[model samples]
Target chain A: MSVLDSRRGGGNGNNDDLASLEAGLDALETHLDTRASRWRKLLSATWPPVLAIVGLLGVWELIYRSGVKPTYALPSPADVGLVLRDQLSDGTLLEAMGTSLTRGGLGFLAALAIGTPLGLLIARVRPIRRGIGPLVSGLQSLPSIAWVPAAIIFFGIGDAAIYAVVLLGATPSIANGMVSGIDQIPPLYQRVGKVLGARGLSAARHVLLPAALPGYVGGLRQGWAFSWRSLMAAELIVHSPELGQGLGQLLDFGRSNNDMSLVFAGILGILVVGIAVELCVFAPLERRVLRRRGLLVARS
Target chain B: MTVLEEQRVTRSTGAVSLRGLTKRFGDGPNVLEDVSLDVAEGEFVCLLGASGCGKSTLLNLVAGLDRPSAGSVHVPGGRAALMFQEPALLPWLTATQNVELALRLRGVGKSERRVRSNELLELVRLSGAGGKRVHELSGGMRQRVAMARALAQDSHVLLMDEPFAALDAITRDVLHEELVRIRESQQLTVLFVTHNVREAVRLGDRVVLLSSRPGRVAKEYPVGIAHPRRIESPEVARLSVEITDDLRTEIRRHGAH
Candidate 1:
């Protein structure tokens, strides 16, 4: 007997019915991508942070007016703003920022290169994971600042020492992130990869790595933070004429000269740079990854 | 003839053949035991069993994801394509890219991969959804993309592990029709596993009921009902009732033991 006995007599009509039915079902069930206007979204996101900054400045001004500490010890917000403006006009602030940013960028890249492979090995190879898994976790928890003295002693207070400290600080977090990312991948994905004939390195590259990406991006953000922190700590400790003037060095310079405004200005610059990198670089990258995977729900 | 010789003869003839397959995990009871089955070229076979019957284990062994503890599984058709209960499409990739990944792994060239993936998506009636990400698609659409990906494997045998068990009833019925059309058009061999008796009756040319807990082949029913059989049809309902009764009896046997 023919399998398509019923279908053959009225196949075209049936197919059209099936097609239309499927379309109706899809239309009824599928989610429409409704979005608020871009300007409204931007305004909503920006206002709260802007208000918080204003409130913080107001409190700082109140404390200054109250004379809670000497002007030399605790400079007013306006005093710090003037110091920042002067440093900006004189080009020293930009130069310090440029120097610190270059170091941070390079250190973060180096950490990424080392950490990615280390994480894959730890995640995939059981014996290696068993051997070094706890050690990587321990390194992440240990204060990165504590490594500056050892790094200086080893590399002798140069750019090499600063990079060493940054690598020490960031590499563990990146590797740990990779481990957790790989661990979190559903076993079904691996099975799907296998069924698709993806084996060994191909499986790792195509399925495992991409599947672990959200976690890996999270790790990268943390790694960048650690790199910046370690670089600042190193600059503060290992100051020399040849080491160049970074934000940390600028802060150290203000301490030596007893310029409280410059000190506050240096603190402000560091805070701004950290926040800027997070807002400008990592936040967008993270949102893009999460949004692509539909992990990020629309605010509305 | 000896059992080995008989097994070899059967294995050579069928598109997929399992001879005395058994599996157990880490000193636990055998999940499957001495279960042998075969699917001829272009045949549609539904493996029906209760939970813990090792139906999934059987599919995994055929797909080469797992090894049989004792016996052998022979698929003359190389590397059967297996679909899970979930769509299992890569969330990072768009629908077309997910299918293309399968083609790329199969060694299809970059230029050809796009054309072939689009054609496959079209075959699944998802031509317009190639650019949509996994999460952007509805549940039914995602499953269709998965079906497209499986088709891209270019394998003769398709193993489905209850691919529609999670769908709403209406959607499931629609996919059942879609599956029938796709099977006929492709001339593909299918080995589908499910606990739903009516589903097995609706889709299969042959329904093989398996006993649970050291899963053994309990019975096989050749469904002689003509195609385009409704799930509610008398023929389909009658067979389903018989099969459900048999399944319940098998489960009761375990309780009695």
Candidate 2:
């Protein structure tokens, strides 16, 4: 309102009344939301998942006590918890997680490096898209575990083989995510860029890339899922003394030793890691991008 | 043809000149057919037509966003800046950043871009809203930011395709005045496209009516109305009625055939 009054003074006095009227209209029309405190918002969001977990544990305890299976096979929740504590005290669980996460992180970075340019090429170059678009999508559906045997033959049972499977698993999803992201950009943006004299590389950098970011982030999330799954599959299959233990290898060890509690602990570790990464990294990133664009409505 | 030949054609034309410009998509009929018009230096011309009359298409051709299938568009003023019905600001950038982008693309240095963008924002009376995101601004304010971005292009010819059509009546009136004030101070040659007859009459030096379905230039009316003209003024109302009658007749012709 003050800005409006200030603008009124300098302009032709004939339109001063009109300027003040406009300021009034603008102020009256805009609706401001009163947001809740941050702590309250966090508590509201966290309660549902916490309740669900507790309910699931209750069900699990009931099943264990039903005596439907032998004690060795149907270990109680407390027994599995004890196994987890034992592994934690010995530092083996931490080591296993560290190794698996390092591999997953490095493998995902590689997939991202390869996928971005490939996706851009497919999205933009008509001939390239026509030639390889189907092939890339086909790769996504073909399961990276199916490549383990070929990867083993090519690179042996080592880090290279594991990384190969991870890349093959995640790269297509990432690339496809990128392609879909670019496809969804409204044609209006491109026209605006052209009018602003942003041609070729400049258009891609400033206009196309930022506009396609939400979709690209979606792809990265899917790609991470694929990488994690592929790494676990490879780790379970390709165990060697030279290669350190991972969550998948730990599960394989438990099965061989017939320790049901250890096997459950390994499964829990894998699930926790996956969910934590999603909640901490991808969900927040996607929410930020969408919220800034006014695509996400703020829940009261 | 060659750049030399292109430069020669532009030199002989007005700020913006169209010579028999024809546009078509694939095998479909021409969207615009043999349409010709001109806007002298610092002139404001409103192209008035009904829906599907190719008003937007003509602006696209003039803005060089689309090319004509035949004939030429000569803009001696270099590339024309276009404003759409929607503000079309990038949602992620703040208002100043959006204006700065146009300057950056024009090869302005970093330090100069900042200063110039602030000046442009002030010109549109959006100085305080420079750091606000696109979504945070009201619809009318967003359009003002859009105007700032367009002005940052420094193009002599400004092509507007119903830029005020989406606004509320009061806001639109305020903007109409803002546009006129800006046009005068900047000495901009404006080609505004709108279907509202009164709006064309209220703002333009001349109103060009285009016939629908192949979009030919049907007629032209030069407004002798004085400046500071109100949208509800008697002269504007009389001209709007005449233009509306002609527009209805033009639309009826399509049904007869």
Candidate 3:
């Protein structure tokens, strides 16, 4: 029997019409996701990471309660939390965070400015790339933290030293990232680019840069890490009144005062800032790039 | 001798011409030798040969993607559009945007690019698929998008190197038909490379057969069949069989060494 005939209830046109209407509605509703349903799907996929983070927190609380170490050696999690609260109430923590973030951001920007052209030159010009390719890779392999002592000596223990170390640390990563980005581009793209009349600077701007964005962005992320680490090392070693109090200084203060809780709080503050920048700025930037290229998939 | 000179004269009028063209890697024997030919305006020619016949090398020379070791190559009409066996679509671009990139490079205005790209996509029977990314497309659809991108340049000549070789039989047949329709409608000049004798006969006005190893033009067939010719037609089958026989002979000669 036909779907309409089968749906007909015994001597009841109203019920039969209702049944057909319900079936049609069901068909229409198929593949449509309500907001709640979409959220449920997202939660299922994300739950594992959430649970692991909670488990880590639970372990920290347990260790603190068990008094694994003397309170002076490693304060309880509650003590650390108390330090964080005090700093927050006094606004010192936020101020220190702002100072560190500003320095890191500026250093990262400077590195990008220097590294991008260096990368493009290495990628496009054979002699230049050959000469500097090995050097860039070598520099990237060199620890940025190693630059701290030299920077202090050269720049005299202040913001200048911090910036110098940050620059040295970050530049190589950015340049190397760009080199990889350029290398990964398919040769076919170059051919197509040339045929389409893209050459010289115009070609670099329109084709090469966009194609290499993922790799370049990856480099930028590494550069930021380098900048942050170098700046912190510099701030810890070089103390000056002219240099405003920052996370690194706070960390130094906690160490000198033998305040383990303050040290833990400072460490947590650094971690939070780094993750926040990546999430709010770089992560979104990368996601937008991938999404524009249709490379992003909904987790669900 | 006069006929050869006349052929040379006719070739000189074409957008692309290759004269005594030969290539070799290092001290090896020539991959192509004395390959003198001219593609007249709006001519649809096919380079038919088995693997290692240097068909791609010749097309590359014509495209200026590579250089010939001997003789000369010329493109009287700027850069030619090249279509490879693979679609070679940019993974980052949508089907429409890919075509638009060609136009954008050609100095087309932003407003004009969108319309032109859409038009080209429609030309390839891929209307409403401009938003589809390259990887999302099927092999045939990708090739068609590739074709649209090639066409976006408005180049006088198109060099295709086994563009349909990887597709299924049905898809290839469909594309072959689509190509004929587009070629006729646009008055496009095509230099198609393929090993399929039937494809060579079906698509080309002239088919140049090349021998293997130290490739040279073994034979040339002038396909007199009209547009929309059927594969099952007596003329197409006859030419296919003849070309296949020549190709077989060339292969057997290579084996004797």
Point to the candidate with the largest lDDT: 1
TM-score of 1: 0.95
Which runs of model 3 end up more than 4 angstroms from their true locations? A1-38, A294-300, B1-15, B74-76, B232-235
What's the ranking of the predictions by lDDT, best on top?
1, 2, 3
lDDT of 3 at B5: 27
lDDT of 3 by residue, A188-271 (tens): 888777766788877887778888998898898888888888888877877877789989999999999999988888888899
- The global C-alpha lDDT for each of the candidates, from Candidate 1 onward, is 0.90, 0.89, 0.81
| lDDT per residue (tens digit) for residues B1-257 in model 1 | 22422333455459999999999999999999999898887778999999999999999999998999999999887989999999999999999999999999999999999888988888778888899999989889989999999999999899999999999999999999889888866777899999999999999888999999989999999887777778999999999999999999999998895
Q: Is candidate 2 or candidate 3 better by lDDT?
A: 2
Pairs that collide, model 2: none
Ranking by DockQ: 1, 2, 3
Q: Report the lDDT tens digits of candidate 3 across residue range B144-182.
A: 899998888888789999999998776787678667656
How much is A37 displaced in model 2, in angstroms? 1.6
The superposed Cα distance between candidate 2 and the true structure at residue B141, in angstroms, equals 1.3
Model 1 bad stretches (over 4 Å): A1-10, B1-13
| TM-scores for the candidates | 0.95, 0.94, 0.87
Candidate 1 residue lDDT tens string, A215-250: 999999999999999989988887899878999999
Model 1 chain B, poorest ten-residue lDDT window? B1-10
Q: How close to the true structure is residue A112 of candidate 1, measured as C-alpha lDDT?
A: 97
- Candidate 2's DockQ is 0.36
> How far is A279's C-alpha from truth in model 1 (Å)?
1.4
